[model samples]
Target: MNKTISIIGSGFSALSASCYLAKAGHKVSIYEKNDAVGGRARQLIKDGFTFDIGPSWYWMPDVFEKFFNDFGKSTSDYYQLDKLSPAYKIFFSDDVITIGDHMDQICEEFERIEKGSSKPLRAFIARAQEHYDIAINKVVLKPGISPFELVTKETVTRIDRFFKTISTEVRKKFKNPKLISTLEFPVLFLGAKPSQTPSFYSFMNFADFGLGTWHPKGGMYEIIKAMKTLALSLGV
Candidate 1:
C-alpha cells in the first residue's frame, strides 16, 4: 500500500530520502523552513558575487556518483566536476603545505616536510584505503539501528580503530607538528577535533589523498540543486 510521507526538511539527506520514498511508490512531500533547499549547503549572493555558504570542497566523488547511479542518473547529468590539481594549501607560522590531487604528489610533499616521512605516509594511507573500503562499502550502508550493525567481519578485525583516536594514529607515525596537522585536517570535516574523532575516520584521509578534491562547476550548492531536481522528478 502506498503511504503519504511528509519530510521535515529539504536538505541533502531529506531530499534524498524523499526521492527514494517516492520511487518506492509513496506520495512524498518536502517541508522546508527556509526559502530554498540545500540546508547548510546553501548559496549566498551579494554585490554581484555569489558564494557557497558552506561545504566548498567536493571530496569522495565516488559516493556522489553512487547516489546518482541509484536513480539511473549521473552527476554529469546535472553539473560538471573539476578536480583541483594542487588541491589546497595549509599555511603554518613558518611553512606552507600544499596538498596535491594524487598520492605520488602528496607523498613527495610529505618527504619535503621531514626526511623519510613519505614511507610511513604511504603505509598510513594504505591502511586508510582499507578502512575506506570497509566504511563506504559496508559500514555506512547499514541502518544503524543496533550496535551489532558494526560487528561485521571486516570491522571486527579492525575493532581497535574504534577505541583509538585519529590524533593517536597520526602522532604515532609522523612527528612533525605540521605534518600531523596536515594529516589531521581531514578529520575536521567530521566536525570534531582529531583527538576526539575515531581512528576509523582515517578513511577520510583516503577520501582526501586517494580520491582527490573536487569542485562542482558552480559550487557545492550544485549538489543540492541536483538532488532537488531528482526529488521533483520523482513526484516529491
Candidate 2:
C-alpha cells in the first residue's frame, strides 16, 4: 500500500525525509509556508551578489553525499564543493587559532599545541562516533512515546556520560583554550550552552575534524535546488 505523508517545511531534514519517503512509493505532500522551497537553506540575492542568510557554514559533507547517493545521484551532479582553507578563524585573548581545512593539517596543528595530542584527538573522535551511533539508532529516530523508550539499563550507563558538562570534558582533555572553544562552539548550534549541552554532542567534534569543512561555490541555495530536483523527481 502507498502511504500518504505530509512534511512541513522544506529544510534539509524535511526535504530529505520527503525524498526518501516519496522514493519508497509514498504519496508525499510538502507544506512550505514560504513561496519557495529550501526553508533555512533559502538564498538571498542582492546587487550582483548572492548570499546565504542562514547555515553559512558547512560540515559533514558525506551526509550530503549520502543523501544524494540514495537516489542514484551524487552532490557533484548538482553542485561543486570547494573545501574552505583554514576552515575558519578563531579569535582568542592572546592569539588567533586557525583550524585547518584538512584532517592531516589539523592533526599537525594539534601536535604542535600538545605533545601526543593528535592520537588522543583521534581516539576521542572514535568514542564520539560510537556515541553518535547510539544516538541515531536508539534515541534520535525514536518517537519517544514513553520514558522506557528513552531509558533502560543499557541507556542508563550511557546517559551518565552524556550528562556530564562539556566544559569539564574539554578542560580535562586539552589545555589549549582556543581549540577547546573552537570545538565546543558547535553546542550552541543545537541551542544550548556547552555546559548545558549533553556530552553526546561531542560527536560534533568528530564531525568537525573528520569530515572537513565545505561550501557550495555559489551559495547554499545550490543544495536547495538539488533537493527540490530530487523531490520532484521522486514525485513529491
Best by TM-score: 1
Q: Write the per-residue lDDT of candidate 1 for residues 1-236, one digit (tens) a residue.
A: 99998989777889889988999999998888989898888899899999999787898899899989999999999999999999999998899999998989999999998989999999999999999999988889787899888788999888899999999999999999999988998988889899998899999999999999999998899999999999889999
Clashing residue pairs for model 1 = none
Clashing pairs in 2: none
User: lDDT (0-100) at residue 81 of candidate 1?
Assistant: 95
Candidate 2, residues 1-236, lDDT tens digits: the string is: 99999998999889888998998899999999988888878877789888887788787787788779889999999999998887887777777767887667887877876777777677777877777666655776566687678775546888777678777777778887776786688778678889887777887776676666788988888898999998999899
Alpha-carbon error at 214 in model 1, in Å? 0.3
- Regions of candidate 2 where Cα sits further than 4 Å from its true position: 3-5, 111-120, 133-159
Report how far off residue 131 is in candidate 2 (Å). Answer: 2.8
lDDT of each: 0.91, 0.80
TM-score of each: 0.97, 0.83
